[model samples]
Target: MGQMRRRGTVAAGIAALVVPLTAALGGATPAQAATSCTAGVGPYQKQAEKFLGRPVDGKQSSTDCTSIRAFQSKHGITPAAGYAGSVTWGVMNLMNQQKAAGKTPNKAGTCPVNKGRIACVDLTRQLSWIQDGKKLVYGPVPVRTGRDKYETRTGLKKIYWRHKDHVSSLYDVPMPYSQFFDGGQAFHSVGVSMWNPPGSHGCVNMTKTDASKYWSLLKTGDDVFVYGRKPGT
Candidate 1:
């Protein structure tokens, strides 16, 4: 993803997070925002793939449903079971943001190991992992990602801090590992995601259990890998 050609200035609409590319959506004609499961699905799926690092035909996985539910929970939204809905749109919006940031999932799935420790994100599969020496840890958590061309970043990153049971807004958003990248993208956990892969605003969301587990195991500068639909070998 490269610097998006903005048609207008981006505005802060939803979440406190705002980027320039989002400006295009803000000015999109009503007809453009309207999504049809037919074509709109592609943009959503494509953006998700950018994060997953592989083509995960959103229609081919139950994880898609699980991911949508997770999105609903994040924004104080309730998730419905089965089928993509309005909530899914919001998730897509987040994914689009990554593209705005010039971090779409490219073809090469190679995230360098920086300083002997690496925190990598795989956009196509929507998964994140941690590596320490030869040890690898994984979690198939829900994420609210950036849009089509705007996807979560993938590269050698680092974990700079950890927050346990951190309070966010009205929810106790627990960040297991706060990996320092651009600004505030952390690896955390929440109490949602009915077992699907929702998008994240760059931040990685783990299960409540995994958040706590990683909280104890993860350390600053430890290697982290964000790839796959689920954390795996």
Candidate 2:
């Protein structure tokens, strides 16, 4: 009976070792694997296509993955790892559904005033756009404007200065693609995650890619309209 008990104990020890080894060899579990954007036909693929401004075909293509990565990067989606997984799908779904429901801007009054080219910042929506007459040239891209005490000034102003690489003397921070409109306040690229917000001092913060695009389109003397109070004042 004592000999039998010892054999059983040895068997149990081997079983425990086997389980962990099998798990390690098998790699990520189903739940962890599901986080990657697999290439194939699926509803998530269709949603990702739509979010990327591609046709919603329910089929995954290389273009779709690239665009998804771009969107993920812009929105500060992590693993920013170019996978349209659960988190990516969730963010895209929420934003796309909201846009479909007309929560996004179609037009702003200031867009038509310039007639040539203008950048309009809608504080209420935390969105910014570039327009020429009635034609939208660029965004409805997300932005982080100044918070309460340092509220970004309202009213129309013209781009008076631009620096492809600028450093803030006052704050001692790098402000790449800085386009100054209202005094010290400028539209510049920020490296910090803009997803969960604290807010900027008095500048308009954009992703580096968006800021570069802005620099390419806007020149000195371009009109910039800062209007609408941020939601909840």
Candidate 3:
């Protein structure tokens, strides 16, 4: 077990990767843009799956489409036909909308940290700390933020679940000791090269030392806080 710590002050700061979705559409043929046969050969399925946490199998076979469509509608983007062709490509170009939704999957103060010696995230300082009933246990280590078009998540919340060494195809990074609080987001590790302000894939990235230290101290139901945005914009 690790040493316990007290809750500290938190501020907002940010980081992450930028794969442009429009580029995917500009290269596709016109025919591929309108045909929506569901499933197979399209970016929609892939994007939707990443958004929904399940396989779409070229068909709207689950609540996946509903979730995807809801996200798209909420952001005022046309939902892809669950395919990877032209339509999917076109919709993807408006990924800023998707990225924004990814940031606020849960409302502020919706997932408050239960007062029982949990973890906390300070987005402004790009730090994560583990506490033990007002005492410090883990850290205040340096972390990275979202890059590309992705925006790292923020707001008041606490971790409810954790996964050890979780890998994701969508985020394309291995989240060591993944702490899932809001939908599809977690505490994880990214390449050291991404050490600047915005060098993550939406989730906050931390150094091995900080992550390992906190990993040992943190349990499932800990308090986690998030705030801040990219350094400048």
Best by TM-score: 2
**lDDT per residue (tens digit) for residues 193-225 in model 1:** 422343455566655555555566567767655
Q: Write the per-residue lDDT of candidate 2 for residues 1-233, one digit (tens) a residue.
A: 00122222212322232122114324444344334544545447766666556788776665555456555655566654446576667655444422432322444364445447999887766667787777666766667788779889998899999998999999898999999999999999998644324478889998787788899889999999888776546
A best-first ranking of the candidates according to their TM-score comes to 2, 3, 1
- Model 3: number of backbone collisions: 38
lDDT tens readout by residue for model 3, 1-233: 02333322111111122222223345433244334323344445666565445574655542444444333432334444433444333333323332332233222332233565765554443445555555545555556667658776777666777777888768555788677766677777655632233256677676555565666777676666676555545
Model 2 segments beyond 4 Å from truth?
1-110
Worst 10 residues of 2 by lDDT: 1-10
Off by over 4 Å in 1: 1-109, 113-117, 133-151, 169-181, 194-198, 223-233
TM-score per model over all chains: 0.42, 0.58, 0.47
lDDT of 2 at 66: 48
Full-model lDDT for every candidate: 0.43, 0.66, 0.50
Ranking by lDDT: 2, 3, 1
Which candidate, 1 or 2, has the higher TM-score? 2
